[model samples]
Target: MTLDEQLKQLAIEAQCHLAKTPERQRSLSRLISIICQSNKLVRPFQGQFQGVYEEIYAEAQQRLFLYLCKEIDRYNPELEVMQWANFLMKKRFFIEASRDLLPTIPKGVDRSRIKRSPLEVLEKQTPIASQVNASLTEEIIQCIQEDHDRLFQTTHIEHKPAANFQYIALQFLAGYSWKEISEELDVKVVTLSSFYGRCLTKFAPKFKAYLSQ
Candidate 1:
């Protein structure tokens, strides 16, 4: 049987409408393990994994499984299970995991090879004053908003002149997903993320220097 058919069969057996019993729960758990562990289902995330993402992968994966265990009923079978599972993984858990890793990065480290999220960078750097939070984030955000120098406004994403860094940063800060931005700007998520990192590396320090003056 095709993997798709097999998943449907599992869903039927694990339907939450069945009688509430420990045996039913155990059987459902076993089925969820099979679905979550399927190599084909998780290959998308696994294949694209890199840098800081690999560090929390295993932990995030457990949370994904636990999510399926309790919320599998929420899964829309009309959607391919793989897409459904990975979407939840990215939207619900991975975004937060990436944010938690951002502040720990070495400030001077090269970002050429390190893949991090725009959300991870900005969400961690808030205007709040506390021992844990830094004011650098506030300064960079201010520079993006004010742009008296027009640097951020003119710094487009490579050839995509319409996608200025100022606009991209606002979208990220406003809680738009990278996928949404990519679709809107007709760019790949990979390209947009890499460009944002380079922009931060090039622009953030300059903003800080001016702010410190």
Candidate 2:
């Protein structure tokens, strides 16, 4: 059988067993082992920082596995298993590797909530929360939404006609995580991420110029 068939069988079999049962545990273990062995998942995890990157990846991977274990029932059969896992990994863990860079704020300040400083924005590629004001954020939102020249409208993820750049930018800038956007668009998170990254690289100058004016 093909890999997807195998994954489907394994996922279904694992789901059939009780959450903490030996059968379920074995099946889940087998699933992840296969994923790693196949190298179907991205590895050495792409990160912004060379140092401490692997460390964060390791931690994020462990967390991802745990998340999958508890939430395996939610795994959709229509999608490729590895793609779903990779989406979760990249959405939740990949960028999370940057946590290592955000250690400037002192601990024990407040458990309820805390805000990042401007320095943290420079240190990591995160949501522009700390970098821009409310009006600036709204301005970006409006520019992408207007699509007067269809620049954003014309750009889309290859093979996915509905997944336009404007939609992705609005959702992303509106603070949707890659995983969430992936679910909404029914597109692979990796593809969306690659497209988003390319758009940022290509359009950053325009974005900056827009903000300056």
Candidate 3:
């Protein structure tokens, strides 16, 4: 199958898989194995694999899964479930896995010998704290509003559950590394990295997209 066809199938499979299963052990296993195999291929072909694949993979596996799980557990979840599932599928299959096929270079040019300019290299690097802080602030504010709405509609609620992303984002923005966030959040470093990565992907794009509108 073509890559696009494969991705379409993958997204459908992912949705069906999530709908049938509440426990994610099987999903995690399949996704992690796919990721490890892709990482093996990608690391050796670093120049060819565009930089965003790793980030995209983390979102598919972690944040999207968490969001879906939350929806499944909710009492009345039709809207949230559909929205999150569609968003997750689009992000994984279309935005993440889908790519234009590059034509092979003609016999004369040495494609492997090409190098990035300084500006290109700089552009490839992530600007960590400032960007993370801005995104976290926005999500935190939204989460707080969500809490307010829930509390206003309900009675005798003690406190709203804090968003995992809000806590982690603020920790990283306050000069803590993934290790520190993991320690505070009581998760493994790998899990923390995965969560932070997924949140950042959704946060950055949504924030930028909103600004452009």
Candidate 4:
């Protein structure tokens, strides 16, 4: 089969694996293991298709797994197996990704609670919060939103999948070191640095406005 056809087949197989019911769990487990092993056959050609292999395959895997878990949940909401797997995989990814990017922030310190000081902004901006309080968190919310929008406008990321950008941002938020991010994301450290610098440059003005508020 052609590469495209192969990828399509992989997607279908992945969907099937993820949708396996409790009665078929063992069979599905063996099937997915085999598929993953077979797919690794392309590892030798990774130098030629690194980007496609990593980004495309990673996305496919995520979608397949998510779809499977979602399907299982639909069948039996009380079944915690799929949910546990989903959480475990997601948590590991976040922890591994963050371990290499930014410093870990302590919990319950008000990540979304905007602090006006330069020092605080320096620290808080590491893991950008998704939601800020409408009243007390308005400053951060507006600034991040503005900066995020501007970055999208200025970059070719507008053409890329939104999930790609979000994934990159999540790495930074997870406090992954730059080198770790480079390795994890399969990009050069310089590339990650430049991308982040662009984000900060676009975000700075908005951050200032937020502080002013």
lDDT of each: 0.56, 0.61, 0.39, 0.39
Q: Can you write out model 3's per-residue Cα lDDT over 154-173, one digit (the tens) per residue?
A: 32112423426555554555
Question: lDDT of candidate 3 vs native?
Answer: 0.39
Per-model RMSD to reference: 19.5, 19.0, 15.6, 21.6
| Winner of 1 and 3 under TM-score | 1
Candidate maximizing TM-score: 2
In candidate 3, which residue ranges exceed 4 Å CA deviation? Answer: 1-163
- For model 4, the local distance difference test gives 0.39
lDDT, candidate 1, 1-213, per-residue tens: 776667666655666544333333444444554564466544224443355455445434534554565555676778776677778666555544444445653443334424546964664364222111111244456668888888888999778887888887767655465656777999766566656656755664575565566
Residues forming the 10-long window of minimal summed lDDT in candidate 1: 127-136
- Candidate 2 has which clashing residue pairs, if any? none
- Score candidate 2 by lDDT: 0.61
RMSD (CA, angstroms), candidate 3: 15.6
Task: Tell me which residue pairs clash in candidate 3.
Answer: none
60-147: candidate 4 lDDT, tens digit per residue: 3432332343333333323333333345344333322222233543342333332245763464355423321111133444444455
Q: Can you rank all candidates by TM-score, best first?
A: 2, 1, 3, 4
Q: Which of the two candidates, 2 or 4, achieves a greater TM-score against the reference?
A: 2
